[model samples]
Target chain A: MTVLGYLANGLVFSSIIVLGSIGLSLVYSIADFANFAHGDTMTIGAYTALVTFGAVGGLGGAVLGLPYGFFLALVVGIAVAAVVAVGTEKLIYEPLDVDSIGLLITSIGIAFIYRAVIQIRFGSDFTRFGIQSLRPIETLIPYGVRVTLHDVAIVASAVVLVAGLHVLLQYTDLGRKMRAMADNPDLARVSGIRTKRVKLWTWVIGAGLAGAGGVFLGLFNQLSPRMGFNLLLIIFAAVILGGIGSVYGAMAGGFLIGMITQLTPFFSNVVEALPIGQGWLATLLENLITLEYANAIAFVIMVVVLLVRPNGIAGEGAT
Target chain B: MSLLADPKAAFADLTRPERWVLGVSVAFMLFLLGALLTGALGPTYFLFLVGLAGMYALLSFGLNAQWGFTGLINFSVAAFFGIGAYGSALMTAESSPIAGGFNPLVGLVVALVVALVLALLIGIPTLRLRADYLAIASLGLAEVVRLVVLNERWLTNGSAGVRGIPSFFKGWPVLSTFPETMPGLRLVVIPGSPIILGTSFWEALLNVLLVLTFAGVTFLMLRRAHQSPWGRVLRTIRSDEDLARALGKNTYSFKMQSFILGSLIMALAGVFYTHLNLYVGPGDLDPITTFYAWVAVILGGSGSNRGALFGGIVIVTIREGTRFLNDFAIPIDPAPMRLLLIGIVIVAVMRYRPQGVLPPQRELIWPSAVDGGGTTETPDSGVREQKGGGGDE
Candidate 1:
């Protein structure tokens, strides 16, 4: 692939990776334990979209139009995520102390519980979007390459969501209080920030964003229980590689990882016939390995970042 | 230092009660197990479950070295376990084209070295990240490792995962002890034995031997280390990193040492896993297994070695026990329901007795007054703030 195509692919990949990581980054830097249930939230979001599409209802009769169904499904997905985010806090994670390792372990336990419950409700089948993995966009300004509507929406939505988050954090009262608490708990409390209310908003908003991301993901690709679970690593890698607490860093990291993923496939073609390329090397890798799974590429990126900067991207800014 | 000031001294007091509880529970479990053996489960079936619990418990103990001992909360225990199993299997498997190229002893040594190096390579960069970052990186690496195994077809045979491993130690002692017959469940033995040890005494024997050795090693090292100045410094680091550093200790180095040492042991555990099943694969390397090991460390008491053993056994036993109890206890399909039991156990463990069966106190004598609770040492402060922080950790 040429450099331009690579850049384009990176942008496409970045949109998804950043889209996923932003919600997690928002929650983690500002939130506490890493949420394992985040994956299921994505799964639930995809299912909401599926149901709205009336794909399951195809067995009977399709009543809801695609656009209307999509909008309604979006609302349902967001609502479900919001409720789960809040409910998990109240029912499972809240009662226990989770500031440190203990809370982290508890989070893992709770995450498993959430996963199990979801598994019971939704069996282990992959849910395919009625649309193709990369549905062609209207191509308002065609550059010879076809941009999938899914890709376009992801890029468009990601831009809006990130800009919205920045504005919310800078301009909103809730954002101010969240930063205050993040800086110093006692001070935030002493300042009468109503930390609880602010936190509730943070999770509802963060989870809602994740729900939207999930829908976006399903539009572009097949949905499975493993979708979010698999992407979580890359999302985290993006967050860390960019800078843990820095949302913008996550966006940058996401794109970088996405490009690397696509580029590996590009790199392999050259190796198959290139002079000086070891026959064994190409042959050894050809049968089992491909790096399109962004998470796999993310792992390599994470190792380098960690070795170079243990504090994560943005270093001290991560906290 | 005051005896209790030394966690080991305080821990010694608790070991007796610790042994008593696991002893009684395991004994009663064994009796019921015998009933399982003679009854519908028959001879070969019970051995399989016992072995699975033993191997899983052993892996958990290896993880406890980090979470239970040094307080790092390593989450990729299964990844390392898988690495060890696969590493050794690659060396000894009958199908391996590379097997005959080297001496068996050399092959085993090379495998161990390879696994050890892999652990260090993965651990060196990631282990210093602290808390969630470390957890994230390890989780990422585990997937990466699995992907590497999956993608490297020539090396790992791709998704088929290298098979036809020569069963290590299966020939030792009486072959019958391994159980010549699992009857209908024989299919489970080679792929991932689930029935034979579930019926046999051999599983219990292996647990006793391995756990005893682990216990011996743990007892001696923990005793001397807890008393030694370095040990005190290590504990200090766990309690408060700033305080330890203020006192002139390099908390970073201590953490690194503990992490590497603990991870190396986890690799050894992988070796045990491979030998048991005579196979290894991506499915075996799932993250859920890692989470279960964390559950073991918590149940064992985070800071105490004996607590780790008891907790590891209990965790494994509970996993199998619930399955066993569900055999006749519940009328519904149990596969989906089993995790619910795990979820409940975790919730209960988190709430009423977050400290676990063994409290974190140390003792001066072998038989001491206190019982060590796994996960007792750390304050619940972080978790209490989880909800306040939003949701996802």
Candidate 2:
């Protein structure tokens, strides 16, 4: 595939990653823990949409190859994911006396519980939505960019949601409160910002975005028990790359990580064509820069980022 | 040794909850022993369970050293374990892509050396950062290692896995052939059931012995380290890194040492597992194994060695018990059930007893330094301080 083709794919994938990373970063800042369950929350959203779409079916006309029912299912998925996160916070995380690290570990357990329950209900198999798959647009195919209408739908929806979020954060009362809480919870609490309520809102927005991401991800690929989990490390890399706790940073980080992951094969091809010296270095690059190592490449990039810029690309200077 | 010599005194030393744990553990062991004698469980399989328990204990010991003793969240326990397993398997297995048919001892040495190098590679970058950075980076790096093992067929045999692995005592003279040479015995433990002891049983006995040696040596070394000034420094670092540094101690080096030590122990567990199972595969490098060790260490009491041992046994029980339930009782799959149980255990432990079931109770001051100071009573103030202060990010 050409660079444009890879870039188009990256754009579609990055939409889902951006959705997932925003929630994770928001929760990390406000909740004060690296929630290992955030990915599973995405899984919950995906599976909920799967069941919802299965039950509701196509209601009428289709836009971008997805039925109106899918849009309905998407809303339900988002609501369910948000509700679950809030419930877990109230029932488990709120009463716990442990610190952020303890909450971090507890989140792992929550991740497992979310996954296990889904596995029990779904039987660990991969499935797709009732919507039919669409072929790449003919005009785009000729230009070496082969994104389908569904891909366009995903990206367009993501852009709308992100824009809505931007407006909410920048202009709305809840947004201001959330930003304040993320910056300094103690200060926000002292200033009568109602940190608990803001935190609940954060869970709602973060997990709702994650749920939407999960639904789009299922549309993009296929839904399995491990679909969200498999993508989790990449999402984390994005969050870390953008600077943990920064919402806008997560968006940029998600875009870059997603692009790098999809463009790995192209990079390897470029390496093979380049007139680099024919030695072990060349051979190693050729061997390591394959599709199989795409995720590994993202992980390696995350480690390097952690090494050089621990606070992330857009984060404030290191303490 | 002191506990064995003065049972009454040791019993008096235990907290009420610890006493309950001991009683339940003893009852459980006696029940298993009863089942063994009645031919309800196969001796070989029973011995294999013991070996698995020991292996998990070793893994827990490794995590305890890092997370418990030093407050370093090294999330790549399974990576080091996989490295050790693959390192040994690639050297000793007949189907190894690089080299094969080497002595098991050489495989052992190779596994440890490779683990050492990998530990240093992973530790150098993340150990200098915040505690959670190690957690995140190690997890990501572990995925990289798993991907490499899964994709690099020439180096690791890929998903087909290294096969035809010999036993740990493959070339140990009499021990190598002892399983085969031993005569089979049949004992009518019950009227209709005949308990048989054969070659497999002897082999399992040998494996149990091998695991016991590994766990025993690791236990001794950790005990010595945990009591020494080195361990005290680590504990101090765990509670308050600034305090340790203020006292002119290099916290980074201490963290690195603890990280390497824990990783080495995890690798040792993996080496034992490779021999015990006689196979190594990409699936073995699953993050589940890392979480299993984490669950074991945390459930057993973070800084307590005996708790780790107990936790290891409990893990085996939970692991095998779920399978047993699936086969004989419920038709539900054991996989999700196990995950659910682990999840509940973690949440419950954190909710009710975050310090674990058997938290380290005694102070960790050096014996010689305190002997002449006339402080005979070992107060657990350090442990209390750790519980309060260790979670500082």
User: Which candidate gets the maximum lDDT versus the true structure?
Assistant: 2
Residue-wise lDDT of candidate 2 within A1-319, one digit each (tens)?
A: 7899999999999999999999999999889999999999999999999999999999988888889999999999999999999999999999999989999899999999999999988898889998889889998887799999999999999999999999999999999898888888899999999898989999999999999999999999999878888988999999999999889999999999999999998999999998888999899999999999999999989999988997899976221
Compose the digit string of candidate 2's lDDT tens values, residues B1-393. Answer: 547677887788668978999999999989998998888788899999999999999999999999989999988998999999999999999988998999999999999999999999999988987877778889999999999999999899899998899999999989999999999999886777888999999999999999999999999899889987799999999999999999999999999999999999999999999999999999999998999999999998998898899899989998999999999999778999889889998999999999998888653544323443333455544443465574444
- TM-score for chain B considered on its own, for each of the candidates: 0.72, 0.92
Q: Report how far residue B157 has shifted in candidate 2, in Å.
A: 0.5
Question: Against the true structure, whose TM-score is highest?
Answer: 2
Q: Find the 10 residues in a row with the least total lDDT in model 1 chain A.
A: A56-65
Looking at model 1 chain B, report the run of 10 residues with the lowest lDDT sum: B363-372
Which residue ranges in model 1 land beyond 4 Å of their true spot? Answer: A1-9, A52-66, A130-144, A267-294, A310-319, B1-27, B100-108, B170-230, B246-253, B318-344, B363-393
- Candidate 2 at A262: error in angstroms? 0.7
For model 1 the TM-score comes to 0.80
